[model samples]
Target chain A: MSAPTEIAIHHVDAGRMGFFTDTTVCIGCKACEVACKQWNDLPADGSQFTRGGSYDHTGELSAATWRHVRFVEIAENGGHLPQLPAGNEVDVDAAVAAMENWVFMSDVCKHCTNAGCLDACPTGALIRTEFDTVVLQPDVCNGCGYCVPACPFGVVDRDPRDGRAAKCTLCYDRLQDGLEPACAKACPTDSIQFGPYEELVRTAERRVSELRRRGIEGAYLYGAGDATGEQLAGGLGAFFLLTEPPERYGLPARAESPVQENVVPATAAAVAAGVLAAAGATAAFALARGRR
Target chain B: MSERDATPALGTRGEPASWARAGADVALQRTRWGDAAWSFLFGRDTGYAAAEAQPGEVAEANRRMRSGPLPDPVEGPFVKAPVWTWEVPLYFWFGGVAAGSSFVGLACDAAGDGRSAAVARKVALAAVLPCPPLLIVDLGRPARFLNMLRIFKPRSPMNTGAWALVAFSALGAGAVAADVAGRPRMARAAGAANAAIGGYLGSYTGILLAATAVPVWARSRLFLGPIFVSTATASGAAACRLALVAAGVPAGHPTRTALGNLETGAMLCELGLAQLNQRRLGRAARPLHEGRAGRLFRAAEWMVGAGLALRLVRRPLGPRVHHLASTLYLAGGLAFRYAWIEAGKASARDDEAVALMGRGAVTRGDALRRPGEARRLASAARRPRHNGRVGAAYAETVRRVSLVVERALRP
Candidate 1:
């Protein structure tokens, strides 16, 4: 597999560093989640046990929770396990086999090549770090909350306590000190790998091919190369290798910066239409007055 | 002032001695001021009570996200809901009115109707007065509101819109000042400048909403701008006409008649564009057609329709019809802003809508990968380096255009 060429484009010295989360090896321990919260000093959002009957207690990534572990239980019939009949006697071994494949994916900020939050931030608070990862400067953010909705992944959120938007900083402070992100460092199984963007992409590709060769046909790289058809606009700096579809991990299959297609055209059309309408109305008034 | 008068003597005259006590029972019995001070110093509830007190819909949505059964992969909110509150839509409405009225003032000035122009300018100034405060108050940190002006970011609609609002307000104020200072030429020039900025101010709000990941807003990107501008025009003209009439302008006056015609025309355009946008959005537009947002949109439609009907029967209804129609148009305009913003919030929560949008993008991507198109994309992706000359030329062109625009916009 050829290495991805777009690397160290932002800052030559540090190189573009990112995560390659391989769900195949993830143990669903959520040590990454704990380490992230502890490192970032992010307050716990809530403690309600999810009704999904999964071990996922932290619902999803929020302003407080940066790393979320998703659990997808697949039945032997290639569907979710059905609720068993209350009175029916079931075979334990058969039941266990039916629910054998349980997928656990630890999700974090994709840190896209073209980040939506960075593009949408009016306050210049969200910036690209030397590692080519997006980071929000809480001090600079005036709590406009535009970044919250702008993030296609729904990663950035407004901290209710402080009113400023918060998200994974890709451990920018740690990277500056020559260390990996808290999540990747804490990951026990090396499922969450952090390194140069190009190296990670190559590693992810090789792993996916290896998995497929070993009869894991569903294994594929997402946001790396063209594995999932068209790439996310500018592609994601942090990519993933997943056995299931991207949506199974609460990730969009296709994402684009709204600025790329929506903002400029919409602004131009609006301004043009406004000018035309205003001019037309003025002309009508001018003509009416002149006639009078 | 004497120290005795400046400082209140604790436990003196009518004051109770218990107020100074540190005991819990004494603290409870203290005056409201003492209680407030105690709470201010020691309260653990310093966190945002407002965040905790979310509206029922939002609370319910949060509850579902927390405790509901796992959503189908393709059918749950994939984006965070907007944190904007009542202040945002209110700001949009006021900003629209300011923009709209400035346009009317410019139109009146162009038509040589000085009285009507002066009234419209004043209306514009009055409308713009509350915009800054509303916007600042809505910010997560009101003190950091100045951060919006700390940079020039054209990529962000919110940033550019802020700059436009500042310029619009300044020019609107200048126009009003020129009118007061008996400088008709200056007033006319300032009014024209304000109207130019106003055109942007009216439309940028729409762009701001559309340029997000929200399904309904993004899907209707093309129409939101025009829809907002049209509503702004209708409302601005309506405000001007009402003011002109109240100032004793005859119903038959050319300015009054022109404004009336303009209001009706803009209202018609707004209604048409909204309908077209809703149609184009398809399933993504469900938020605009259901729940609280839907109700507001329907009310706006009814009000606009009624206003138009009133305009049509003005000959029979007399000048009273003008007042009624103008009022309806203003109310309808406000409703449009609120409805659109509310709809956007709802749309962000609709996972199915966003999932469908993502699916649509994937389908388009698939279509593009057909044989020759795939090769083009692959080659583009494989290109080792960006062509520097083309990049420099593009940058130069952009720089030159912005310089020209800046020069033209300068007052």
Candidate 2:
């Protein structure tokens, strides 16, 4: 792959851009999903059928389906749903009016600060755009598919037909023209809001505080890491504010970076291998003396 | 996007009906997400729910991990179905043998055993010279293989490995050439460099597997590297000793005895570390105990045990016994490498293991259930499988301790 800086030499800096996803207000209208397909010119990924139980069933993020909306409906004892809104009080009657009482969050590529797919792509086909979000240079990808499993979030995949890797670009083409991502643009409630990265984080934090202040206990902003700790992919460029645990929204409870997970074990294994080889060499003398 | 491509019309990725076919994926398109509303009242993976959540009916559990119906409809996430196939593992075995033989050559040189050193060097060259070609074959084409050298990203091990292979091969060629040209000093220096690289060459393949997110490989990270090196050196010892015996090295030669002892020690470490890794991994180790992988693992264990027994009487053992043990040791080494790979595929195929890499104790029943059984009977061990996995672990520890005692007090 060509050098990122040299590749972007003609294009001036656009500053950092990202998505501020508030899953709280999402209506799951799927307008963003449809719009992304149309803009990207991607084919439908076989999700038009009734998938038994869930509404908004595009399944998951794949090579084709860049933006996915996940629906989770939790009900306790009776038929009453867990629509315990900001007040923390569950009412059977109010939940009935809440679109079958399912929490809807539109999911997309996290575009992590430390993107594993980018790091793992041997061909350098995955590179950081001027806006700092990761994009796939499909023409340069050699179809190695290393980025597929390398993704901690499993957002990338090899297109079976072309034998090349594909994923969301955060609409890199749109960003060049000072336009927002298609999913964000088509979002009816502005749940998938796109803006400057820093501004989005600040506003997302304030939104979290607002939601929590209103009595939503689980209202936390995911992928907005500061100096304190690193969260999903060391804080995603595309992050979210959710009213439930990450797992409840089809996210990892602890979305660890592949680097952290790999380094510790790799070091230990390397050390052990080196030590065992040395020990075996020394033990040979002792064992031979006994044999004689 | 080519108009001719027309979306590729890829089918759902499911297990193929013809099990013998390799890498052919069929479409059973499924969405992994579903509402956890009234479905909570029913058991999971049992049946599909026709009804949606009742009006306002709050559900208890709605974890997206639990959203998919059980007995997974799609093939579990294998990512790339292990990019390095038969050629890679075979290359690993050959490269390891070369590395191990280099150590033998070094040892024989130090001990002033020129005949043994000569054979070892020849063996090392013979084994290693084929690696790059095997690796290229695995990569599908020489051009694609060259693509690996397109970058020097140490952050990516694949990048480092490509560069390392080039260096290792060049150094190995230089050593063999010097050895043949009767330039002992140049051969010595080249051999030393080759040996140093061999340390990495012999074991980096295992590290490559461990560095991946695959649960079985990831969990065995601490042991895989060591295990690879052990097998490499042990089998190298066997191959070198057999070559010397064929070259008419005297029956009572100290070099032969020492090599035999070295082989036993390495194999013992391999046996102990292998079981320890598998047991520590618990549910993740399931792949090592079932199917073709399991058979291969068992064969490797048996061969190691036989080789160890042969080592006990190696000083008095006839040339025929030495040859038999040598064959077994080499076979065992190959078995271990191949089995480790097959186990990786098995580990990836299991949906439950893929999903549940626990931070702590999960369920005991997950560990206890044998392969392909849907009915999970949760006993005292539960899903996290504390005691069941430990059953194999205890036996291994006992066998290892006895072998250590027997070898240590042999004189």
Candidate 3:
């Protein structure tokens, strides 16, 4: 897909830039998360060790926690992963054998082509940056919170301290300075790559084919092509290379902007119904008066 | 019979005294903040430290807290819950009332009933008075509420709705002023203008809710607007009727009778549309039928039903029955608004419903596709199926209902 027209209108000769997160290479070390938090100066949410003995304690992405590492443990038997034994004596080999795969995905905002949050914002708080990335202007936001539910990925949220919506800007400031995002810079495995949109898509396509040739049949590009049901409104600025279903990574298989479908029909129906009902009421009143 | 002897002497200093002393000791221990603070600071083995001292027990509790079935990542609450509180729905109800009353006032003027028209105009103005403050108070930054008018973005229903409300309020006030000044022609023109704006004011709140990622609201997009407008009409007519009664209008006044008929028709339409929308939503409508929202919806339905019944019997009971029916309609209209907003909140939290909607499973026929786009995508075998079984079933039901209604209307 071509870069959105808003990009050309807003910035002269600026190309669209985005992230390509290859989950297949993710190490789950969470360096990206730490770097994101550090660079953004986000407040710590305190330590929370998840119940399943999984190392992913920082839960889903929120206002403060932009980049999140999700841990999915799949079982070889197509059932739940066996819980760790309560006794001190544990069979490590058997437990390991029972697991089919343990996948880690670093999740962030999609910066959709047809962004729901941007369309839903009443105040001009959310804007498309020169690099075609969606950015929220915190100062202009009246904190109406329409953008919260408008997000299809459940990414943007209201900061409790201030009540203004917050999400990843895809590092707009860093992009302007010719520097990579902190998450991409800190990723040790090169899992999170940042560059021009076209180049990244080509690289992702080659990697997917290479992975398939290497017998990893599940390797595919999400949010880049129409093949995956996960194609969002047009496509995502930030997309992923995955080895499992999109849902396994807490992503929708398909998404649409409510604005395109719902607004016009609803408004038309309302106006039509209102006019018809008013006419009927007026007729009833007029007839009753005439009969008087 | 021997209670006095069997109860023993009151306050006798024996085993009872020892028990009382033990109780007092325990209460003193509980109330001693200084001792608790000292134990907390120094890690002393006071009785207060017992719970923290047992690491094994604490660990077990933590384990239990975390231990449960693993969450299904696919069944996601895909969007954040709406931040709107009570004020938003209250504003919607008041706005509807104002909008509906303005229309009724215009209708009364068209019918040449100037007395009732003047009263309706005043009622519309009063109803609109609370709307702005209610909307502003619900904003996260109340001080910057005027920022809503900063840009006129037609793409956003909220921005347009805000502008409509401002215009409606101004016209309503002007119409009321003209009525007081005995300028009937000017009042009629102003009231007509207000009613024109009211058409949007009464129903745009529904569009506002529908134009969101919330599953239930978006799925019912076709019907929410009509439902809300019908409720607004019912409540507005009811309010005008009550105002006329209070103004010492005769029970047999043609205007009063006409309003009763209008209110009844609107209430019936509101009830029918709500049911049809719920049926179409299927599993996604769970929020509307199950919880605090469900109870409110049930209450609203019953209130409307009772009002309809009262309307049917009002001929025998005289105009006093009109008062009760009108009150019921007003209350039901308010409750309907609250229930709908509450249901939208709950639907946003339903991960499975949201995910299914995203997958084009629940909201099947409501695909956001251009003409023949679905066919083209289907030919390529890339598009998600948008005509699923549930959608077909809902379509069949709608078809059947329309047929029945058509046959009933035919001579």
Candidate 4:
């Protein structure tokens, strides 16, 4: 029989911050990936970029990418890609063997409180649950691409395979049953943790302190703790713990939403269009009359 | 502006009756400022004393998140929950039909083309047929779409639009029927009717969106009307070109050329207005010029530009080119609508946009404090706050006006 893998899982409300990823502790095994997919019933995206430089082929989060373990491999001495440690040859095998510094972080959708995707959805496809997590209703989506740009994080996307909008539902159905999300369930390292939003924030803070005490002072939560409304995109529903800055993982430094400003110009253009159209119609009539 | 125009005579014996005149007259007459003080208490749509606040009003609920602890539901910024979905169909149907019908009447009137007039009348009636479907299909409860007619509220664009649509539909139908009966005299009257109803049909859509609390639509209310007019004209011209070809008129018919000229001019107007829109909108406008919708709008605009150039050069590209150009212009207009809707929703989704609008409201409140303006805002503000449902329903009314403007101005 297989040994039971213990990973921490918690339930949280929508607004409280959570997550502090300690990349230094990660082994890049992608146990989190298997757990999320196996539990979520997510179809496997075939690995093509796998086996290259300690990297996992799962590059991002999608409806399928509920959890993706990113692998960033450094030289034995910790340097750039395509270059070998001073003692080793540059072949793929040697590179993998010589690689001593590898940072693995599992990423997922940040259930944002000020979710622009949910706000922009004309058909109410995107909704926030009582848990404060943002989820998508596939049936209600009209496939209007408004949410694509409205999302500051570029998390929500249209399934080109299907026309409807798609994003992680944060395992909403499971949470309702008083269970943790699938991704957290399968994490072998206790790295991808889940819990109440407030408790998670506190846990993440304590975890950061613990790591800092252990001499890994660089550990920090990305969208979690101090990521306020001004600094983040409406505050992430699922905040992250990270050792490096958010931008290193492709998050924007600051976010802005344009919905309010657009009404003024849109209204003005509409008004001008109305007046000009009337004038033009009148002119057309005059010209026709002149010809007569 | 011309002496000969004489304010374009609201109703002439030779002209068809317009519903807009009734609406405009109602609006002008119901100006509470000029009427007795009691009028404010009983001011039709503007009057809130009789109506109960919607159920959602007791709880400050935005379908989207509301920041900084929900305010007292009874406090200012109280909104009636949006009763209807902001249906995309309404945008298309109302604007398309209005533009198509208005063009038919106007073109036939201009050319003295008897067959064209008959076709125009038929098309005009057909245009009005879509309004009910548009309104009903987009409603949360399609059955309630008809309740809009109960009160003739001047401040409520939806009420005005409902009355206008009904009036326009009757006149449009009568005009067509007269033409079908070979009543040239009545046909002339229908043309006049079309003229009167048609003028405001296109402009009302702009007014509708402008009156909303939706910051994107409210801020640019002034220009949206003109843009709608321009696009509608371009579309009307395109529709006319199609009708002409269907009628077996040769590609180079004088009427076709004239329609082409109108379309070209309108396309130019739309482009110029969009440029102006870019300047006024700041970052929100980025979605209009970038990404898929932007690409489509730009391509359509380019096609119109090329078509305009071809028409100007007088190369006589034959029916195919003209037809292609006409379709291109129509496509461009639709793209513009798509872009506008996308941009508006995008703007609404942002917390910052709300904050910015919130701050702008503060400054606006400050500005209103001067002289008599503050009193009006305060009074206007005193009008019962709507829940999100009511706001949505109200938005539909404004959308109706926007739709009309889009149709009326089609080329």
Candidate 5:
């Protein structure tokens, strides 16, 4: 009874499960990050040194770092601080006067409605779980990195430690045990919620409205619905509620469902090119025949 | 212990030392972040006080450190996703050449040029024979390669491509065998089917790249297929030309000229389409024209031009000139595939390219406060150079030249 653009041939048994990460409430505790690794048995990306950037110590999502908490500090004085002027020239006094605004978001896989990784897999390695979340079968993945580039959000990655494609599995094992995901369970603020996809969307919508009512400008649900607002990647299975545009959170403004947008045109272009080449050869043969 | 007890707390069961170390490390991290954040707050990297009118924009230094579209604070560059390496592009090159050979063989057979057709068939077989092994190499094991067939996902281009490669290789080999065995009718039918299969084999590679979400490849989706087809046809004709002349088709012979002319025309098409693809992509095409990949692509273009010049303008009527042209064309074709594939990889690493998806061109309108701030904030990144008026003039000149070449040497 569900409509997805990728595969209609197969029938799935279970209801779709997803996450609704509300960035507004994230407290930058790194609990979800710690929880995801503990559950997934992933390693720390590396020893944390002075990154000297934002509050972000662990740089990004990778095979080792399954979950990432992004800390975007938007200063009211644009992004300038008084001590540090543009480039190497520093104005220490001016930097101190710069205004800072913090937006914390715990990032994870979208588990897209039309997954590019699954569609691009040549070896049938990436598969949708019974819970309707995309999961990787390690035994089948042959280290081919097609899925890495295929992801619109750039989530799935090849583990440099082990040459296999890997990403968040939406805690498929825990789902089997009738439990919620690790990240959601660890969220102290309940910013990251886990439940049935439909129920979460309803709750998320009300939460956005409540936030807007409280004078939170641009507090909207991304991938909510095609009719309401942005329905990127045919609507992210793991959607978000953001105060800023998607780009600020490193999410694509219009996450493409490549299976439909990129693939269809590619197929049509290939067919047309093939026909042109064939016709060119035929005309040559016809000319040769005429001479004979 | 039950499953509840068996599962680690918070999904992890790190050693107590590591946990303690993690906690201590976070404290250390906090100290460092605190210092940096303080420095940042004081206009450390902020350019001007007036520019700070907006709320979210960061100082130029912070943007420089981590400049991608995503909110990721630490990951500096763009997506460093490299799923396909040398094997995939090499596979595409070989597969396209094989398909092109089939086209040549079919045309020869239709025209009663049995000797050339036989050579073409052998060339087709030789070109395609390595495809299966190459694919196996990419997949890491033979069983993994075979696993692609387990599902007939017409919805997935990668699956369809796997099947198409197998079909083309099998039919090409069969046609070659039939011709060798003196089974005229069998060879003719197989060769005909091989020709049909070749069309898919020649052009499917472009679709494979285009269908992906990589900004550079995806943006040029409309033209890459045609570009690949043109390259395939030229390379196939060049291969046949080399084989035929080696077997003693004289330099001045109509067949040599005809094949050379076809190669020239197809290379011209490939060149124009590549430019068209680049122009259409705007800033997203920077990776295709900028680094090692860019160097290789420009080299390929020059080689194509060089091949055409050698055949058309060079003096001395010898098979050597034609042979050199064939060699240049072949080299150019290989370079095209390799460079295109490499460029696709590099393009994925571009955070700006990723951010520019759906909304191409990092313009002033993106953020009114800065009014073309991305350029000032990101001078470290290589800028894509465009020459629209001159490019149009050049395109027109190319069209006129191609027409002249085609008319002067029609098959």
Candidate 6:
């Protein structure tokens, strides 16, 4: 007996996992934020609250905070806001009047196909899950921090407290339990959706087309069809459907794999270092013999 | 339970109250996350029942913390993996062994001491032994060791290295085998083979580094080759004396001093080469003098200096001092390898090294242009159209070289 090329659609494991984020529908309620924290049992972003920034403060994605809701207050009248302006040093009323759009996005680890952190990790602490998602094993991490700088998107981070690596698991536990991620479940406006990977892709595609029809031409899916594109076929496991170019959300336009450029120079340097050391020792011995 | 289910959850069952308190405290810490509904629902202790768990919970936590996360995350972009870190160290090991063995061989040959020759052979074999381990360590998948032989690309220094290493190993083994065989003719042939192979291997390691994208290694290729060659010569001498000692050869031998002088000369050259290379490269040399690499480099320099001092007082120290000197030289050589690895990595990591090397390269190119301009001016009288023209006109005249040459010769 051979495996069936065409199986009944119902019999297939078509429950591909994915994520749906509706930035427009998001009210910055942060209910998903609290749910993620409670479920994951993560620590606070920091000891102090950052006041200078706009509505949402958690700053950036780090070991502590997995989900970050960025609050960008769009002003009109070609003016700036009193505290958080869309532009720097402009009139508030004018900016508010001139404001064409107000935007908010919740950022998370992309689970990139070509994860730099995974590639740079010396201890094999980083790996890919069956779901094709990037996952980290903290226990094996040597805290070398090579993965920290290797990341193109700056997603993975080291916890200063434990000196071990930490990041979102895409709720691996919840995922294993046959439930949606806590954040997605807790989202009030269905802003976060989790399901089969394929379904999510189709849904995202349809959503983009619908948005474009509605004159939201800026709507775009980041890391959806591959953010770095075919240049790096290493597709992202945790991709995003964005309403703007990825750069606006701090995503790299073109991230090159470091492994491609590093092998040669690194090998050569190692050889030189080794040879010089041997020669130095040999020379020292010769000097000693000369005295005798 | 299946083997997977038999394994407990990553977070071990602990004192529920403490766990709950820990969660509660965390909640109190964050105002936005810790509202009344969350506080009411989870409570101060939540449902954590840590007290029921066994003492093994601690160990379990440690284990889970280590292995549970399985794979780490990809955070940023544009950072290359640390292939260099492992690669540089292996290079150090190979180069060190090669140079050390060669030094012993050179000294033994110069002394014409049979015991010294035997010692040199042993040292060479010993030096080569660490190479496989170093190479394996640098590879991500050590099990696929045979892949190193999959290609014979000339552009790849590593490919060339495999061959160099093979020749060196064979020659070294032959030399040692002949010495052990106690045959005069065989010993002489082995000695010659060792000398020729050792010289090529010693210098080629430097060229290997220089041929890469590594700015520091590439810029100092010429000097690096010579330095390693000379260092090998000194190490070979040291190994020769050490061998004689092991064989209990008589002390106060004149040949010992000659080997010592040879070593001293090599040390002086190494020191001069290091200084010159650094001066020429400037900021690119920072790695050689800083951090772990810097410490190792300084230690090597100190060892070489002290070894030189020992040479000056060998008469006072007597024959026993040769052993100590050989040991120092050996230690210093390893230190240099470690330092060089660390320094090269640093040079590659830091922007300054690349900038300095690039500037040096550009300057060298600029310098070459001046000589060409001067030559053009000297030959201007023969080509009137090209006379005094430097950039475009000089090129055009060169392009019409046959006509100009014929016109000048016709007169």
TM-score of each: 0.80, 0.71, 0.80, 0.53, 0.77, 0.45
Tens-place lDDT per residue, model 1, A1-292, is 2233322234455667778887877788889999998877666666544424443557878877899887666423345543443444445676456445677788888888767888788877777766767888765677888888888889998866556777898887666555577888788777787777876666666665555555766666667655233566466778777766555666665677765557876887899988987897798698678778
Q: DockQ (C-alpha) of model 6?
A: 0.04
Query: Which residue pairs overlap in candidate 3's backbone?
Result: B76-B351
**Residue B142 shift from truth in candidate 5, angstroms:** 6.6
Q: Model 5 residue A181 lDDT?
A: 80
Could you give candidate 3's per-residue lDDT for residues B1-411 as a string of tens digits?
112122223333111111112222433333212221222222222111222212232222222222232235442436778889999988988888888888899899888888899999999999999999998878765555666665656767888999999999899989999988999999999999988899899999988888888889988888988999998899889998898888998877999889988888899999999988888787698999999999999999999999999988877887677799999999999999999989988998887787667555664463443322331112122222244567546534543453344335435
Ten contiguous residues minimizing lDDT sum, candidate 4 chain A: A1-10
- Write out the backbone clash pairs for model 1: B76-B351
Residue A225, model 5, lDDT: 36
lDDT (Cα, 0-100) at A218 in candidate 1? 68
For residues B8-52, what per-residue lDDT tens digits would candidate 5 score against the true structure? 334323111111123223232332112222222222221112221
Model 6 misplaced stretches (Cα beyond 4 Å): A1-292, B1-95, B103-115, B352-411
List of chain A TM-scores, every candidate = 0.86, 0.81, 0.88, 0.75, 0.84, 0.75
Candidate achieving higher DockQ, 5 or 6 = 5
Return the lDDT, model 4, position A82. Answer: 42
Query: Please, what are the lDDT tens digits per residue for candidate 5 over residues A120-207?
Result: 7776667766566787765556566667777777788886435567789898766655567889878877778777787766666666
| The 10-residue segment with the lowest total lDDT in model 4 chain B | B73-82
Q: Candidate 2, B95: how far from true, in Å?
A: 2.7
Cα lDDT of model 2 by residue, B28-66, tens digit: 312211111122322222121223323211111212222
Q: How well is candidate 4 docked (DockQ)?
A: 0.04
lDDT of 1 at A191: 78
- Write the residue-wise lDDT of candidate 6 on B280-384 in tens digits: 654556677788789989999899878877877878767667677776776676676667656655655554333323222322432343211211111112211
Question: Candidate 1's residue-wise lDDT over B298-404, tens digit each?
Answer: 99999999999998887876889889999999999988888988898898888777775665532233233332221111211432334367654653454345334
Q: Candidate 6 docking: what grade? A: incorrect
DockQ class, candidate 1 = incorrect
DockQ for all models? 0.19, 0.09, 0.17, 0.04, 0.17, 0.04
Write candidate 4's Cα lDDT for B129-194 as tens digits. 776676655543233344445334444344566677778788887877787787978877866676
